[model samples]
Target: MKKDIHIPVVEDVYIAIVNEYNAIYKTQDWNAYIINNKAVDLELVLIVTSGYSKKKATSVFRKKLDKLPKQSYAKIELMQEELFALNNTFKVTFFEGNQMFDKTYLFRENTINLKALQSIPLMAVKGVLAK
Candidate 1:
């Protein structure tokens, strides 16, 4: 008899949005939030990405999240310099009950719209959870 091992997978979890904000120093800042819409809890989540570029991708942000509860989110701040570029993407990886999950999200995707980002108010606070 052959034994079949069940593997867990992550679903309904994604890089919900990338938001821009006005800083006190007359500059801008950005925040990338990851939302977990599933019922299971994700552990040791790592969010990494390279800034927008047609030539070569540069590491803009890399951080590990301890845990993300169900129907919750984790936020990662992006450097002001990184916000100016609009052609980048994010790679999200995490573990769900010993099963590893990974996915890549583009900045221009339906989740994050370039046009909408440009029109946001200076201090306006918007997040994927609101949408």
Candidate 2:
């Protein structure tokens, strides 16, 4: 029976952490964003995020979006520099037409630093894309 079910593979959707300048604070900050590179619109987008380590953990955060247009992006949260020492996870789920898709993106410990940034799609700045 399990073999009869089909699970679609997720594509073109990514979670990225970008280092941006905060004009108000006059400092750079790390921020998380969800990028939708799919050709179709995403509906009822939901995301659950958290950070953890061997002896420490951060509170979980939930975010929702009514719709994410094709080739667009949305900011998820501001990530503190201290959190970079721990493993951060982002669980994203959304609907494309009548089908549902979900993906879990992880940024391993000490992996979200400026030295690892690259050109991210749908954004002007460079960032680290979660794996």
Candidate 3:
């Protein structure tokens, strides 16, 4: 059942395990195929909720669960999507899993670099003419 698998989503982050081997390992299975990354017939099936930018999602293991409304689910339709949502989602897992589950490491200062999406104006200026 889909509900058996817990997918965590925050804001615009969306992630999923695509490579069959990684997916198996992620779901807590220790199969040989996953142990050695030996799956040669698998394709990446990353699904995400809308609002995720293409550049921010890029990772093989981490994924974002797309923002689902209260008591609801998300709908994914794009076929050739990018990986930004996945990367952002993975970053969260990386931080959370380290802080809560792994008790081997100590706390340290974490710094983040914020990046803003850029856009160019396409329409002609009203007062200035191109020379």
Candidates in order have lDDT scores of 0.62, 0.96, 0.22
Q: How would you encode candidate 1's per-residue C-alpha lDDT over 53-124 as one tens digit per residue?
A: 556456567889999887776676543433445455678889988788877766642334444543222224
Clashes per prediction? 0, 0, 11
TM-score of each: 0.64, 0.98, 0.15
lDDT string for model 3 (1-131, tens) is 99796554323222222211235335421110010011121122232222234444322332333222322222222222232233122122212322211111111111111121122122111111100
lDDT of 2 at 116: 100
Instruction: Report the CA-based lDDT of candidate 1 relative to the real structure.
Output: 0.62
Task: Kindly report which residue stretches of model 3 are placed more than 4 angstroms away from their true locations once superposed.
Answer: 12-93, 98-131
Residue range 4-112, candidate 2, lDDT tens digits: 9988899999999999999999999999999999999999999999999999999999999999999999999999999999999999999999999998999999999
Instruction: Name the TM-score of candidate 1.
Output: 0.64
| lDDT head-to-head 2 vs 3, winner | 2
Question: Which regions of candidate 1 are displaced past 4 Å?
Answer: 1-10, 18-29, 55-57, 79-84, 109-114, 117-131
State which candidate has the highest TM-score. Answer: 2
Residue 71's lDDT in candidate 1: 74
Q: Is candidate 1 or candidate 2 better by TM-score?
A: 2
